[model samples]
Target: MASPQKTSRKAAGTRAAIRRARPASGRAHSGDAGDDIGLDALVGHAGYAVRRFQLWIFQDFIKTLATVDIRPTQYAVKNVIGANPGLSQMAVAKRLGIERARLVHLLDSLEERDFVSRIPSTIDRRSHALHLTTRGKAALAQFKRLAAEHERHVAEKIGKANREQLLRILACFT
Candidate 1:
């Protein structure tokens, strides 16, 4: 095996090479270093663009609903449950791409807040049916209103026509 001092020196040399490669503009790069690593290659990739857009949407959504004290996933889960009352937990997990255990934790928090209830399933005794309580319905209504405002912000950022086109394009993936 290489000596510890040799490994340390090699690592330091690698870091120095990275520093030398960085742009001289002094602006922070995307991943690391205090320089821009021109994103020409990433700019053309659809997945990269989509990920960047998703990040922006999430940040804006979180900021918009900061007062509501809800996260993007929580909002999505509650919305799905609100719309599909009496849905099975596993069904919800599948629909929302959330793991069963993670969904249970989210449901626990919502139940504690009186925003959701897990009732005994009529069809499957092993599974629980999810539903929103009266308070949850009211809260969901408010959430929808704020979410609309967030959508409006999105529309403003990207014009209505572009947003519609983007949605049409993204629908293929969903």
Candidate 2:
């Protein structure tokens, strides 16, 4: 059995250790040694910043698309196909920055879902033209509405002014 005074001292020491471990400013400071877990150059890196923003937006995207059951990439593909009926598969792939091989597989999935159809091009026998089905049009409409809401939410989060500036900066790279 320990004395009350020794127990009090031990409790006091534990509190002091916790206070030392956590800095007053909230973020933990690396003591004399260098093991600070802080955003050093990651905050300054453009790719890292974009990836962070993408992750943030994608979380919201997942929630918004849950009812619709379509991913952002799928929505984009449907949008392009809906807008540009008779567009070549290669053209869609190029515009989306996707490879032809990958786009073919993606198209296969959409076709299986009956969202899109690939017709042999009259002008180019080697190419297949893309078209969106009635179902795809409905999904694209829902996606556009959800996407607009997402855009507004993101703008509110980052501030409209900052969002515009950030968009301009991002556009320069693209």
Best by lDDT: 1
Question: If scored against the real structure, what TM-score would every candidate get?
Answer: 0.78, 0.74
Error of 1 at 170 (Å): 1.0
User: For model 2, how big is the CA root-mean-square deviation?
Assistant: 13.2
Clashing pairs in 2: none
Q: Give the per-residue Cα lDDT of candidate 1 at 152.
A: 94
Best by TM-score: 1
Q: Relative to the unseen true structure, what is the C-alpha lDDT of residue 97 in candidate 2, on a scale of 0 to 100?
A: 91
For each candidate in turn, give its C-alpha RMSD to the true structure in angstroms.
12.8, 13.2
Q: Which sections of candidate 1 miss by over 4 Å?
A: 1-35
lDDT of 2 by residue, 1-174 (tens): 889999999989876655554454546465635333344445447888789789999888878778877777788889889989999988998888988898888889899988999889999999888999888787688889988888898998899999999889778655
| TM-score of model number 1 | 0.78
Over 1-174, each residue of candidate 1 has an lDDT whose tens digit, in order, gives 999999999999976665555555534566775335645445447899789889999999999999989888999999999989999989999998999999999999999999999999988899899999999999999999999999999999999999999999988765
Please count the clashing residue pairs in each candidate, in the order shown: 0, 0
Alpha-carbon deviation at 65 in model 2, angstroms = 1.1
C-alpha lDDT values of all predictions: 0.87, 0.82
